[model samples]
Structure formats: structure tokens, C-alpha cells
Target chain A: MSTKELCIHLTELHAKSLLNDNDTFLFDCDGVLWNFPHIFTGAVELLNYLTEQGKRLFFVTNNSTTTQDDYAKRFNDIGYKAKPEQIICTAWLTAQHLKSINFKGKCYVLGMQSMKDELEREGFQICGGIGPDPVPSDSNAVTVDTLELEKDVDCVISAFDLHISYIKILKAATYLNRPNVLFIATNDDASHPQNDEIVKPGNYNAK
Target chain B: MSTKELCIHLTELHAKSLLNDNDTFLFDCDGVLWNFPHIFTGAVELLNYLTEQGKRLFFVTNNSTTTQDDYAKRFNDIGYKAKPEQIICTAWLTAQHLKSINFKGKCYVLGMQSMKDELEREGFQICGGIGPDPVPSDSNAVTVDTLELEKDVDCVISAFDLHISYIKILKAATYLNRPNVLFIATNDDASHPQNDEIVKPGNYNAK
Candidate 1:
């Protein structure tokens, strides 16, 4: 049989063997556990059943918009028991990855509040993410001077952001020009599901 | 050439290239950094010189008797500017390893206070370590019942313990008999440097 046919079907014995081989299970959040406003039917029951069988369950997600504390609260509010440490989101993963790579310099972030929060919680120095918007000036007669990048900025991280601007991207690009500077992105999803339609996400701005 | 002759005749140019190729350095704590009761001369100066050259440094040690916080305090007290996060001791490594392996059940530890503290900080449920010793019974009429291990214990970690007891070893052995239980040891050094003499350490008790 072709590989396409095998992908669409699974024998009962094969499924049973796959399930019995591992003591740990990892689940994704959006589109798998819950989509926006509604939780998947019987998802809670499946999680409880896994727990009853002494399986170690971890929730891994590409969603970097929500903090681990917020995710934990959402899980408990929806009648599912979860701790903050059990939710491994992309924001936390990015911080851990940077630390494991022995990053010691400040970061230039083109991201949202949760990403900044996660990095700061790990004691990383971050810059150019959130602040008051730069005031717009229409004076063209003013002399233009060469812009200098922040020498202390040595890392660039891009994630989903509702308030992304050209200024943030410029700073991130300046940092990227330096040798040995680390660059990372949380996810590369072009579009995400909404209530009734798919909408373009922050990846467009990240580019 | 003999091994002793080669060890005493290293070329200075070779040593320079070896140190210049790496941007990060990890130093061991006990014998490499300092011996007992005396800090190595000019060690602090060398660390500062490395910092001046923008080299990232970390202290890695197998000593499980001190928590990260205690180690940081010791460094600062001895006039070295070091943070707790820059030090990776066996206590912290053990906790991280358990988390990485997705351990979900309680742990039974035959170890020291630092090991228990580090595990508890990471929200691990630990049992059977660091409590008041059971009262000694001198009468021959009393009979000890069959040992009952903690049913929820699914991991056993053995480290250096000043007050090693047979009861803790029995509990560890009982947990190890169960299938799928993780067994970990911080270090297996037969002896360690004391104030003046090399004395046998806690490995025998751990076994």
C-alpha cells in the first residue's frame, strides 16, 4: 500500500502498541485542546483518564501570547487540574533555549507582553518590545543623522504581537547584523483560526 | 615520552590556542577551583580577567551538600562576584534531570538537606529525607515489622548525606525493586578531601 493510504488508517493492534509503549504524553493547546472560546468535547475526560493510568502529561504549545500562570488559571477554571510548571509554552522555551546557549547580553524583542515577561522572569535583559509609541513628526527639513544600534543588544526574538512596529524591526535588524548574536522565533504560522474565519497573524509583521 | 614527561612539558602556544577557541568556560568547584580551607592564589584575578574579555563562565560541581543559594553566598563572601544561577551543582542538575524525564510521581531521597531543598523548590513531591532520627531501642522484646515503602515514590536519588541511616537505604531499595522506577546518584566518589585528611564519603552508605 502507498504511504498516503497508511496515513489515513491505523490498525487497532498498532494503535494499542503505540499507546502502551510510552509513559508520557504531550498535548498542544490551540486547535488541539481548545479552539478560542470552546473546549473540545470530552477533552477533560481524556486527560483525567491519562492521569488515572499514571501517565506523565505535559501541555506543550506554540502559543507565546499567554503566560504560564494565565494558562494554569484557565485550565483550573475549566475544571482541569494543571500547574503552572506543567504548561510549557513557546515563551518559556525561548528563554530556556537562550539560557542553555549561554546568552549573557541584552535582547531586542519584536514580540508581545508574555514573551517579555517570560524572558524577564529568567533574569534576561530585554529591550525594544513595549513602551509608549514614538511621536510622529512630519518635519522633512530637519537634518538626518546616521542611526547607531544599541551596543548592549546582542539577541533578537520575534513572536506574535498586536503592537508590532517598524521601529522594533529596525532595532532587531541592527542587532542581527552583529556576529554571534542569537536570533529566534516562537512560531511561523501564517494564519490562525478565529471564531468563524482564518485571519493573518503577526508573522507578516515579523517579516 | 612517558606520561609524566609529557604532562610537565606543554607548549605555551598550544595552551593559548586551546583557551582562545572557546567563548565559554566551566570550572569545577573542589580541586580545580580551590582545595579545602584555602582559596587558590590569583583565581579571583583570573576570573575577573576572563570577564573583562567577555567570556561567559559557569561553576559546575558534583557537591550535592550545598544548595545554589548557599553556594552563591559562599562565593560572594569570599570576594567573588557570582550569582546563584551561574552555579550548576548536582542538586540542581538532579532536579532538572527529573523534570526533563517527565517524572510525575513522588520521589524517595536518601540524600542531604540541599538535595531536598532544590527538589522542593522545583515543586517535586519528595519523601524520606532529613528528619529527626528514630529513637534507638535497647530492649530485645520489641520486634520491627516488615518495612513498608512509600507507595507513591517512583524515583530514588542518592547523594551525600551526613546522617546516613539504614532505614533510608531500605526504603530506597524497596522502591528500586519496582519496575519503571528511576534511580539516580549525584556522584560516586569513594573519598573526599577534608580539613587535613582524605576520609571515606557517603557512597558506601548509598549502596
Candidate 2:
């Protein structure tokens, strides 16, 4: 079938997925369809198309770990019809990985709270925030998130949080820097669209 | 006049002092007026009485280093009337001094952005924000708000910036431990008022 036919078929499947609550369509935002400034040609049309077909749409990203408030604001700023609930990050996913592995203890989270809150509900405690700052060595710290081959274990995941302050990025780097620590991340995309800027501010840059 | 009458008049005068804006009636909320949950009975009354007189009011506190916006919110939360402009803090006041004294060059800010912005505008360059969990090096930043004070410049000034966190405090105290450098604090009041909470988050406890 032609690309147009394929898109239409995907929309039909999206509608079926939403009806059955089984849709898990994760699309890379940048370069897959359009370039930076994210005011891409068919952005809204795609979302509307999916929603019309009742597809559960989620915009998974690697470079977000701030807050839902920031995410909604940024997505709106960039003309993306993204609800805070729809955007995902590696930080959020990592929180889950820790929980699935029965990781317990306070974490100094350097990322967003939504994912951290999810992890916390599963009995993980965040000692502090993890991001671009140096992670504090609180006795309660469990681990920082990264996706390295030789790192130790807990679980790894990702989500988007925007508080990319130097302290956040730097501290997460420090935890991953440890030889004994396990590291995991999400997306690991080369580039992501920020409000008006392109950011590679996540683990890949540290790598 | 008799002591009773004299006492009554002094009470009335102290009540009026709130609005006097003459000598700058200063009170430390933590220890002077009240403890953590209560206020000195006379303080609010005096403040109200002063407001009736349209006096210029200044609240100086040492315990907190939150931004003026945060302070204003705290004031509103507790039923105290405050404009962000009317509040004075050691962190704020210290930033003022640093700027006024021509603190220049890339210096690590041992305080929050509210404090950093004030100093940065005063012509000093901010090398980085002192992390919430600061390192020994992060703790010991070469910041000189005043150059002429003995030592090889780069003096550290204390403000009631609550965001200084534990590590920053350790660094500040350690930096001060050295005899060659100068350490200055903007105020010595034991605490500041925020709604009902009397915080000792400032350097009063650190001292």
C-alpha cells in the first residue's frame, strides 16, 4: 500500500487500540517527520487523526525530567498538542525499573516527580532530586538513572522532566560515573525539541 | 507619669512603632517575638497599628533565604501584609552589598538565584550555582563581595538564603575556618516570620 494508505490503516488500528485500551504507539518527535521549532507540517493533523481514531497517543522523549507543569508549558510553547500525561521520559521510566526490581530506599531524584511518584508508590523513596547538579551522598540514596552496559542493577527507565539545571545534569552524571552503580535511561534519542531550542541534555551527552 | 501610665504609653508607642518607619523597628521572629508556632503578642498589633499610621515598614530576618516572592507568599499565607519590596533579608541585603561594592569576575554563588541575580546584575559573574548537595570545593567557592577587607579578596557574605542547603553551609563554615579569608553576614537576627513557622534556616544557627 502507499504511505497514505498505511497512515490511514494506522489510524484505524489506533482507533481499535483505544477501544481495547491496548495502543502503545511511541513516535520519535524530531527528524522522524519534521525539524526543529517543531511547528512541523502535519503535527496537529497526526494527533487529531490518532485521537479521532481513539488511539492512545504518547510522545516518548529522552531529554525531559523537569515537571509536568514545565512539560505542558513547553509543549504548548512549541505548538505541540501534548498533554502532560502524554509525554514520557527516561527518568520516569528508570523510577519504574527500580520499583519492578523491588528497589527500596530513599533516592535523590534528579528528574521529574511524576515518574518518581510512581516509583515511590511502589515503595521507592527519593532522597533528593537528580539532574544536572552533583548528587548528594545521602545515606538514603538508592541510585541514579543511566543505561550503560557494565553498570550495577536496580532497573532502568526514562521520562521527560525539564529542570535541566546544571546541578541536575551534573549530579546524575556523578552517580552514573560510579563504577559500582547501575545506570539506565530512556529513548536515548540524538535530539529532542525543546521550546525554541534543541537539547541533547540527557545521558547521551554524558556518554 | 506613674509606671502604669508610662507602661501604657510605651505599649501604645510600641504599637505605633509598627507604622513609625522612623527607627526601623526590627524583630527576630524565631527567638525575640515568638518560637516556631506563636508570635510575640505585641508584634501583629504593633504592625497593624503602624499600618493605620501609614508608616514605612521594614522586616529584617536572618533565618530564611527564600526569594522575595516566596517570602511574600509566606507572608500572605500567614495573614501578614507584605509587599515583596518591603521585605529585607540578609541574603538580599548581602547581595546588595556585594553589588554595591563592585564584586566582579566569575564567582560561585553560595546562595540561590534570587541572591545570585541581584549580585550578577551588580556586575559580578556567576560561575555556577552552589549545588543543594554541594561538594567541599562547591562549599569553598572564592566569592569576594568586598575586596578591601584584609585577605586576598574573594570574601563570602552570608544571606538568609534557605536554599544554601547543608553542604553549602558546611563549605561556608569550612571556608570561614581558614583565617586568611573574610566571612560576612548581612544580619544576625535569629529568625524570620513566615506565617506561623519560625525558621532557623539562616546562619544564626550556623554561627
Candidate 3:
């Protein structure tokens, strides 16, 4: 048959067959489940129906700005049952990846507070991501020669940061310039949808 | 002749021949003429000799941290006769490039005050390079939704900035995301020598 002929449309018969064939469901939160402040049509009903059918469900997203706990809270707020373990977000995955590699040191982050919280929950020391580290008022005051870098920063994590700065880049580059220092980016998304007209820059743009 | 056999040492005979063959010479400042705070042994003598012989010379460097005037001042301070016109640095080159293209708009700078001075001298309005634009102390106070961006930015220039921040990156990225906006980088140097042990991360690392 041709490719177009092989394509199947979603009907009641097809839906019943699909449910019977699949024991689990995976949903992407940003666009599939909801777009924040508004849930998609039948998204909640579908999740409830899936739960009633005893089908396992997992929420997957590349949002590193929020932690797994944050995702769980968001899902519950929207009337969806989501456990911390059931939400697979970039922030949680980043921490998990570090743990899997047996990394034991401080992480200099260029991301949000939630990313730091996720790493901290994984028993890692974090720096650089919480608040602004603006350039000195007198630009000449802080030269690379005078800037003090942390001695124990073993990894540099790049994620979605609203407050990325030159000082942070200098520190991250200086640390990564050393041998065996790890450079981790939570995601490489170029931009994220904010609304119909504006999109926020992602981790790739920070580079 | 093989490459090794063709290579001749810089004896007086070869030096005389080289001066006779070439009427103009170009020198790199960092490692060649001086290492900063210390001039090489015969560097000054050679420049004086070249000037006596009426050889035209140029000082070229990828350093965007200082203006051409700064370079001329450095050379004169080290007992070398250098004019601003004889010095070619990245900061000067960047401004020249913008002018050459007939660019007539504001520049968002991720560089030093000297770089800003160069652009201003070339008749361009500038922003974002002077001082500390740290993230707010309360990180939660600012989100992508609430972040304010400048509307007049037409070009994003990335140079050697010590005070690069998340806010700057956001602005640059947002500006560049527009269709007609330009992105310019002063240099692509991976690293610059500090002394013997430590190397400062250069413009390339900022990316």
C-alpha cells in the first residue's frame, strides 16, 4: 500500500485497539498536556481514563528551569496525578546523569535555582546560578588577573538561565579550560515559546 | 631544498638581507615585542633600528580589551615611537568594520569600556558593557515573562567582557533572534597568556 493509505485515523475502534496494544503512555508537558495557565482539550480526561485503565504514564520535558518536584506540583495543580519519579525533566535528568557518573564535586551552574536545587538534592555542591553576578560598577576594577575563581569547581553546568553574565562565562570558561573539568548543558534548545509573538532564548543561545 | 635546509638563522647577514627585501614590517605585541610590563631584550633596539632605516611598521593584535590609543600609549611607554594610526587592534578593527558597512544603529556590547569608546568614537550609541548587571539578589523576582529588553538594539557585539552576565546574554540572544539583527564578535582567540602558569580565557570561550 502507499504511505498515505497506510496511515490510520483515530476512531473508536482504533483507540480501543491502541489501548489494548499499549500498556503505557508517555506525554510531553509543554505542548501535549498543557501550555501553562491553560490545559489542552481532553488532556486531563485522557490522563484520568488512562489511570482508570491501569496504564502507566510518564511526563517528559526538556525544561530545566523547574525541578521534578516542581513538575509534580504543576501537574497536581492542573488536576493530573504526577509523582516526582514519574516526571522526567532536564533538571532531574542532569542530576541523575551526574550521580550515575559518580561525580563528586561542586558544580558551577549557569541556570535557574531549580536546577541548583535538583543538583543539591542529589548531594552536590552548587554555585553561580542563583542570583546576579553583575560586572563591577567600575569596569576596570575587576580584571581577569584580579578575579578569584573557585578552586573546587569540577563541573560547569549550562542550562536555562535568565541572568547569564560575562563574569559567569569567564568563570565557567576558566574552569572548563582546566584538564578533566566536565562541561554539562541541560538542553540545547535554541528557543522556548513564551506566547504567540515572543520566544525566550534557551541554553544553546547562551553559548 | 627541503624545508629544514631552507630555513636560515637570523644572523646579521640574513637580518640585513631581510631589511633590504622588505620595506614594511608587522609585529605582534603580546609575545613578540613585549610580554607586557617587560619588553623583550632587543625588541626596542630593533624597532629603533627599523625606524632609522625608514621602514614602515604596524602593530597588530587581537586584543579587544583596549583601544588603539591605548596600544599606542603602551608602545610609547616602553620607549617605542608608535602612533594610533600605526596600531591595529580588534577594538579599532571592529568599529572600522561597522563603519565600513555603513551601520547606523545602536550596538549592544559584551566588551570593555575601551571597546565602547572605540564604537562611540566611530559615532554609534552603545549599551550593556560598562558595569555590574548582576542578576537580582532575589532570583525569583525576574522571569523571562517579566524581563524587559531594549528595543533599539540592532547589533550584538561579543568581545572580551569580564562582566558578561545572564542578562546580557538574554538581551543579545533576544536581539539576534530578530530577522535583520546582526551578531558580531571582535575576536575568536581561545586563550591569552597571563604569565607562565595561567592562561586567561579569551573571546572564543565566551561562546
Candidate 4:
């Protein structure tokens, strides 16, 4: 078939057929629902319509800097009804995954406080994510021989870390060098959109 | 030739023949001349003997934290005759390469002060290599929107950075996203030997 024939326009008839064909819908948050502070037009109405129809709706996002509860609150604040269970962000998913795997050791996180909070909510001991672990003023002072690495760290989780430092990277790398230590990254996006002219580095660049 | 025949033992006859065959010798620092603080037993003697024979010698190292002059001092401290001209370390090489390319733009470095000094010696403007660029006290305070990026950074150099931080990584990635920005990495080693029991993360791990 030609490309034109294969394309399906989302007309009112097609929308009705699509809604009837699917019992659940998954929506990405960043570009679809809203772009930061401004919610997209008609997005809340569509979500309410889906909810009224008793359809399952999930707001999935790769953003790990925000927790599931925060996302739900954001959705609610923007006139869309959302529950924590309906939000599946990376921070929540990472915690869930570790909990599912029965991870019981200390985690060294290269991420924001949101990720740490989510992991702590799952009853995991955490370190290295809350603030900056800068190298000493004397650059030569903090060498690998001088670094005090925690022996019990069993996992290194990399997400959107604004406080990522050489010391943090060193600790994570040392922990990950062990044979059994697990390495997990929330997302591998090259760049994150900030505003019109600015973009931020993602976990991929940090790695 | 057979594998066994290809191997040449450094016997008296073979040593003489090999010395006559090559007018220059390139040596690596870590495992060859010394293993930090202790010079190998015969390494200095061999270097001196080579120098007496008028054989040109170069000490090449992937270590970027030490400048050419520093390496020469290290060699002299270890009782080996050496000069700054005989050292071809990554820091020196990186500076030489940039100079060769006639690059006059400012550099955003993810490296040590040694690399910065080397670059400065070449008369290039530098930033981000001296100390820690920590995130703000509040985790949510520093976002991409608030980051003040330098507009004239035309190059990003990645080496052995003890002060590698999220702010530095963000700046490097942002600068690198431009099509004309050059990204340079000194070495891609996975790990560096610290002591008998510890291994440090290399530039590859940081990348």
C-alpha cells in the first residue's frame, strides 16, 4: 500500500472507533499532556472523557526527577484527575523494580532527591543523591586511595542528577566494579528540553 | 613463524641486536619505569644506558593529571635523566593537538588542573577544570533554565577530572550539542590502578 493509504487521520469517526477498540490508554506527559507549567488544550477534557468511559489511563514518563505522587498532583492541579497508581514515572518504576527484585542493600544514587525519596519509601537505604559530593579543594587530595567507599553498597542507580560530581561518579564506579553490584539507569536521553533556547544534559551524558 | 619463535628473549645477544635495530625507544610510565613512589630496580639504569648510547627516549603516558614538567621532575626524582621535551603525556599531547589545529576558542574542560595549565600554556582560554561546580543547596534550585552557560565555548575536553560535577557535565553536554563544538577525550581507560587493593574510575567511566 502507498504511504498515503497507510496513514490514518484521527477524525471524529476514527476517534470513536479507536476508543471502542481499546480498553486502556497510555499517555506520555512531557509533550502530550503539558510542557512544564502550561497544560495542553483539550488534554484534561480527553482524560476526563476517558475516565468517564471507565477506561484505564496511565501517564507514563521517563522523567526521574519527579516522583509518582508529584506527577499525580501535577495532573490534578491541571484539571485532570490522576491517582498515584495511574502515574508510572521512572523514579517510581525504579523503586518498584528494586522492590520486586528483593534488593535489600544500600543504594548509591546519582539522581535527585525525588528518586531518593521514592527509593526510601520502598524501605531502601540510600546515599549520594541528596547534595553535592564535590572533590576536595586540593584536587590532588582526594585520590582513589583516599576515597572511603561504603562496602555495603550493592546497587548504583543513575537518573537525572544535578549534583553529580567526580566523587559521586567515583563511588558509583567503585561499587559497580564489584562482580555482584547492579547498575541501573532510568533513562538514556541525550538531552532534556528546558525552555525555548536552553537544554539540559540527561543521564546519558552523565554516564 | 611459529608463536614460540616470534617471542624474542632479551638475552645479551638479542638485547644488543635490538638496541642496534632501533634508534629510539618509547616507554610507558605506570608499569614500566615505576609503580608510584617506587622506581623499578633496573628502569633508571636502562634509561641512562640508552641515553649514553645517544638513543632518543620518550616517556609517553596516558596520565593527564600530571603535566610534562611534572613528569620530568618525577623522572629526575626517581634518579632517571629526563627532560620536559622527552615527555609526551596526554595533557601535553592534548595541548599540542589543539595548538596544531589553530583553535583559538575557549575550552570547557572536564579534566585536572594539569590539563588546564597545559592548555593555558598554549594560550587558549579555559574554564571548568580547577574546582567543583556543585549544585545549589536546594536540589530543585538548579535547573536547566537557571544555568548560565558560556556562549563562546567551542570545545569540550574530557580527561581525568576529580572535580567532575553535574554542572560541569551539563555545561559540557550543552556546548557539545552545537554542531561546530569539538569534543575531545584524552584517554578511554576503564579504570586506573591506585594501590594494590583499589582501582579508580577512568575517563571512560565518566563518559
**Model 2 C-alpha lDDT per residue in residues B4-115, reported as the tens digit of each score:** 6654444767855634547455544555545534666776676666666666666666643455665667666666787877677555666676667665534445655566
Better of 1 and 4 by lDDT: 4
TM-scores for every candidate against the unseen true structure: 0.45, 0.35, 0.83, 0.88
**Poorest 10 consecutive residues of model 4 chain B by lDDT?**
B198-207
Candidate 2's C-alpha runs over 4 A off are A1-207, B1-24, B32-42, B112-114, B120-123, B134-155, B159-183, B186-207
Q: In model 3, state the lDDT of residue A191.
A: 73
Chain A of model 1, TM-score against the native?
0.81
Candidates 3 and 4, the one with greater lDDT: 4
RMSD of each: 26.9, 21.8, 4.4, 3.7
**Positional deviation of residue A35's Cα in model 1 after best superposition, in angstroms:** 63
Cα deviation at B195, candidate 3, in Å, is 3.4
Ranking by DockQ: 4, 3, 2, 1
Give TM-score values for chain A, per-prediction. Answer: 0.81, 0.48, 0.89, 0.88
Ranking according to lDDT, highest score first: 4, 3, 1, 2
Instruction: Give the lDDT of residue B13 in candidate 1.
Output: 89
DockQ measured for candidate 3: 0.37
DockQ of 1: 0.01
Judged by DockQ relative to the true structure, which candidate is superior, 2 or 3? 3
Q: What is the model-wide C-alpha lDDT for candidate 3?
A: 0.79
Best by DockQ: 4
Write one digit per residue (lDDT tens) for candidate 1, span A32-99: 87875689998888888788888888999888777889788888888788889989998899999988
lDDT of 3 at B6: 82
Tens-place lDDT per residue, model 1, B10-106, is 4998867756998998988886668744788978777777878888889999888788998888788777788899899999999999889887888
